[model samples]
Target: MFALEIENLSFTYPDLTPALEDVSLQIKRKKKTAILGANGSGKTTLIYHLNGIIPAQQGRVKVLGQQVDKKNMQEVRKAVGLLFDNPDNQLFSTTVFNDIAFGPRNLKLDPDTMTRRVQEALERVGIRELAERPPYCLSLGQKKRAAIAGLLAMKPRVLAFDEPFSGLDPEVADQFREILDELVEEGATLVFSTHDVNLAYGWADEVVIMKAGRVLTAGTYDLLRDGQVLKEAALPLPLLAQLFRNSHEQPRTVEEAAALVEPGSGRLKAVDSSR
Candidate 1:
């Protein structure tokens, strides 16, 4: 089952340049899909159509078997939860718990079940201690977690994120990665956008590159290893890809590279660690 199936989808804002043109693709279910593109590449515009945030101007969008239209807009939204680039846009309740509860509350689940889900979501995202804190007083990382908790409470089939790690510090990003790793391992279907080729290489099971409102390419994560594709999208090859350009043994992550560079493997001597 595909997490998303989009066909001939096109959208253009009034008096603005086209944001998406003839886009068509299917994201695999229960896997990490990363859309890579520079600014103005329409990555954000595309995911918005996955939910009902941006109405379809041309073709079709289906989320987890439910066709997206005015009739099934709510169902499509319920199937796919979007995590915005900015936490401020999603968090409105005074306390973090209430902010997270907002989505589940709308579902009208029995009060006991709603409370259980809300608390479980908070614990899953590691924000239970901050549940009573005012969202405005929390740190940015905390706010992001709170926002994600809100989506988790809804239990959507697919979770879409515009730019999950855009503004986070290195330490915070590391922490965020841990949470995402757990989710992905538990078979949570995710579609997230990022301009960071390294992040896409390390995190995504599938990669989709966009350029000027068009899909430049889409395939397995190894597709990012192709310098030509990245070059066309004005992106560089991932750091690991660059490091192993001439090598037959390609390592996608630091852990893999380190394992391949064991005592006297000779591979370690050729690499310039300074990079």
Candidate 2:
């Protein structure tokens, strides 16, 4: 079953400029999807529509089979967890434990249940040690994890992450990606918007390219292997993709490229000839 569906979706800002135009897409259950676009491409606008934070303003938006509207607000919000692009916007509680516990507490979960959920959520993000520290004192990466823990405590079926890897060192970004991958493996439907093409290529099961407030292409990794979609989105494919483009082979991932590079394939042949 599809976790989220947007049909002919469009939205306009208060200024009357179109933020999204004729955007239609589907996020399949338990699949990790990367939504990539340049700024002003309506990536953030589209993510908001998924959770009914910003209403359709024009087209239809549905979550887990229910069309999003005032009537479904409670259900939609409960089912779709959005980790905001800025952790500061989401974390307001005085302490890390309180921040993580805030969501479940609002739901009126019993004390024991809420406590268990908060701890598990913290551990899931690998930030259990920081549970007592003030959120403002935590590192940027730690703050990001705290925000994710808050969403996990809510137990949403579909997880929507906005720029999950932004503003972090290479090592921290790698760690964050690993956590997201683990979440996907455990059956969370994930949709995240990012400007990083290489990370999207390495992590996502499917890719959706957006530009000028519209969807450019939606396809599997194989379909986006060439630089075609990336180029259209004003992004570049990873180094591996560049090698594959020059060689005319289909190696989507780093591991796949390593295995597919026969000794006679272009550069490998050149190296062998030089030796």
Candidate 3:
């Protein structure tokens, strides 16, 4: 079943500037989907509509099977957890524990259950040791983790992140990647927006490319191999894809590219010239 289905979705700002125009897409359950676009391309706006953060100006947005509307806003929010691009925007409580506990507390879970949920969320995000620390005192990476813990505490079935890997160091980024992989392995739907073409090419099972508030294309990483589509989206071809494109062997990952080239060997040595 699809985790999210948006049909003919369109939105415009209060001032009448269009943000999304007739956008339609379906996100499968328990899969990793990447939304790629330049700034002001409606990636964030699209996600806000998923959780009913902003009412849709037109068209239908259904989460799981329920259509999102005023009456079902609470249920929709509980089922979809959105992590903002900025951790500071999401973390408001002084203590890490309180911030992580906020969502479950709103649900009026029993004290024991609330506490258990908060602790598990912290542990899952590898921030258990920072539970007592104030959010302001934590490092940027730590604050991001705490914010993620807050969402996890809600145990949402679908997790969406906006520019999640931005500002993260390599090690922390890899850690977050592993966390996402684990979430998918455990049957959670994952969707994230990013400007990093290489990262999206290597990691996403499905990719949605947007430009000027419309979807340019949506498909597997192979879409990155299309120079025209990449050009239209204002994104460059992934390095590995570009390097291997002419060889009739498009390698999506670094390891695959490595298998195609050796330092001492000729550039096209690994590529069979005969079709």
Candidate 4:
């Protein structure tokens, strides 16, 4: 079964400001999906429907074959964990360990299992040493990790993140990527929204581009090279794709881009030497 299925989904705030309109897509099970869009493009709104955070105002949203509705929300939430863009929004307990333990505690897990789950989550996010630290004192990156540890403690099958890399330094982002990779390896379906076109191009197995509350297109990283779609979404072509487009080489990653410009046996090297 698809991890998530949305058909003709639509949503609007109480003031009638449209957040999503006639959106439709299917996210494959256990795959990495990237939702790319500019701010206010409905990426957050769409994910909210997956777990019934924002009830479907119109159309259907199904998670793992169960339709999303008020009655099913608790079940859906247990299966899907969402990490908001701001770590502050998710971390509330005095200590990092308490924050991580909060979810499993809600599930009424025994003390021993709860402790084990919290520790496992802390280790998974590489934040075990921060267990005793207050959430208020942690760095933004540390808080982000602690927040993710909370979701990990829930043991959800589907994970959603909103602008997870925002405000993170390159080193922290790389570490976050490793955590995401580990989750995927463990068979979790990961869906994340990002404005970083390069990150989506390099990391996502499938891409969905949105604009003004609607999906402009959905496809593989190859979509990154489509100027028309990028233009419609107000997104620039990924730098690697733009630089290699005319050369018949479409490198999807930095490693591939490096190889494409290698000192010998690469046309780019000769071009560079001329300058």
Candidate 5:
């Protein structure tokens, strides 16, 4: 079963600006999806619907085959964890440990269970040392990790993240990627919106591109071989793809591109006749 399914979904802002229009999507179970588009293209608006953050205005949204309505928002949220672009919006508790423990506490899990979950979450995010510190005192990156720990404490089956790498340093970003990989290995589905083409190109198993609050196209990495779609979505082709030139043999990462060109070579022996 798909982790999330949205059909003919539409939403408009309080100011009457259209945010999403007839957007339809299905994210498979145990898979990774990246939503890509320019600013104001509704990537965040679309993600909000995944976990009932925004009420369905004109269509249907199902989380793991269950309808997302007021009736079961609690159940739906337990199954799906959402991380916003700004950590400030999600972290409100005084202590980092308290923030992470809030969800389990609300669930009324046993004391030992709550503590175990909170400790695991902290270790998963590499913030064990900061557990007793106040979130107000943490840096932006630390706040981001603390926010993530909050979600991890819930043990959700699906994770929806908006610009998850925004506040992270390179090392921390790598740590986050490893965390995502570990989650997928444990059978969790991931859907995140990002502006980084290289990250999307190399990471996502599937990609959905949006334009003007509508889905322009979506599919596997092969979908990116069509530059017109990327252009239409106002996104640049991945840097590795641009450097490789030959679409037929494009590499998804810097290491993959390096494998094709020998070290100390003046230029690639292989040339794209199309270029």
Candidate 6:
């Protein structure tokens, strides 16, 4: 069975319009999945369903073979760690260390174990040096990492990140990507949402595109590239894919695309240089 599953799940706010409509999908265990779409496309809504924060009124949502419902919320919470788009929404303690330790505390882990988990989590995000800083005192990127550390301390099997790289400089974004890759490598299932197609292509093993509160497409990187789902979703293709569109050969990387597009001897020279 898939690690996480959503079947015809739909959600609507009391007064606002529908946030998600009959959306269904599955995430394999330990696979890194990226949810891509334009803003207000219900990407965040879908992740919330996985964690039981937004209960499905129309269809079923499951995690690890168990359906998400009030009765199983405790189990579901332990299984899924949700990182909100805004770090402020996730971080809630006088100091960074307390914030990171909160999850383990709720789980009733002993003080010794909680301390170890907090330290490991902070180190994992490379924020160990900021352990005592106030949440409001840290930089935006630091807060993001600390927020993630808080979730990591819980040691959840699945992590749902909403717009993780929303507002970071290039260097910090790269660091965030590395942290995510490490978590996936360590067998954590990652479901992250972002509109940045460039990062989505490079980072995700599979892409699920959402539009108008429903899934428009779901596939591997090559499948997404072959189909014009991006255009249909009102999203841009990855830059390299955009450059190589309709070309006889498809290039997976920008350097490869440069080699493919450059003329004759120059193309050969570019390939050699990349090599």
lDDT of 1 by residue, 1-275 (tens): 78899999999999877999999999999889999999999999998998989989998898877778999877877788899999999999889989988888888889999999999999988888998999998888888999999998998878899898988997888888788778877877899999999999987899999999999999999999899999999998999999887776678888888877758755563455555
Query: Candidate 4 vs. truth: CA RMSD?
Result: 2.7
TM-score of each: 0.94, 0.91, 0.95, 0.95, 0.96, 0.92
- List, residue by residue over 116-148, the lDDT tens digit for candidate 6: 999999999999889999999898999999999
- Tell me the whole-model lDDT of each prediction, alpha carbons only: 0.89, 0.85, 0.91, 0.90, 0.90, 0.87
Model 4 CA lDDT for position 63: 91
Span of 10 residues, lowest total lDDT, candidate 6: 266-275
Please report how far candidate 6 places residue 256 from its true position, in Å.
Answer: 5.2
At residue 238, give the lDDT of candidate 3. 88
Supply candidate 2's per-residue lDDT for 243.
Answer: 65
Arranged by lDDT with the best first, the candidates are 3, 4, 5, 1, 6, 2
Better of 5 and 6 by TM-score: 5
Per-residue CA lDDT of model 2 for 181-274, tens digit only, reads: 8877888899999987777777788888898999998887554565777788787777666665646455556776666555564344222222
Which should have the higher TM-score, number 3 or number 6? 3
Q: Higher lDDT: candidate 3 or 4?
A: 3
Residues 165-189 of candidate 4 have per-residue lDDT tens digits of: 9999999999999989989998999
Error of 3 at 62 (Å): 0.4
Give lDDT: candidate 4, residue 227.
87
lDDT score at residue 224, model 4, on the 0-100 scale: 89
Give the alpha carbon lDDT tens digit for every residue of 1-275 in model 5: 88999999999999999999999999988988999888999999998998898999999999999999999999999999999999989989889999999999999999999999999999998999999999989998899889889999999999999999986788888888998999999999999998887888998999999999999998986576667889998889887777666545677877777666756875555656567
Q: Can you tell me which runs of candidate 6 are displaced by over 4 Å?
A: 246-249, 255-275
Q: How accurate is candidate 3 locally (lDDT)?
A: 0.91
Candidate 3 lDDT, 1-275, residue by residue in tens = 79999999999999999999999999989999999998899999998888999888899999998999999999999999999989999989979999999999999999999999999999898989999999998988999999999999999999989889999998999999998899889999999999889999889999999998999989887798889998988889888877776687767777778776767764755565566
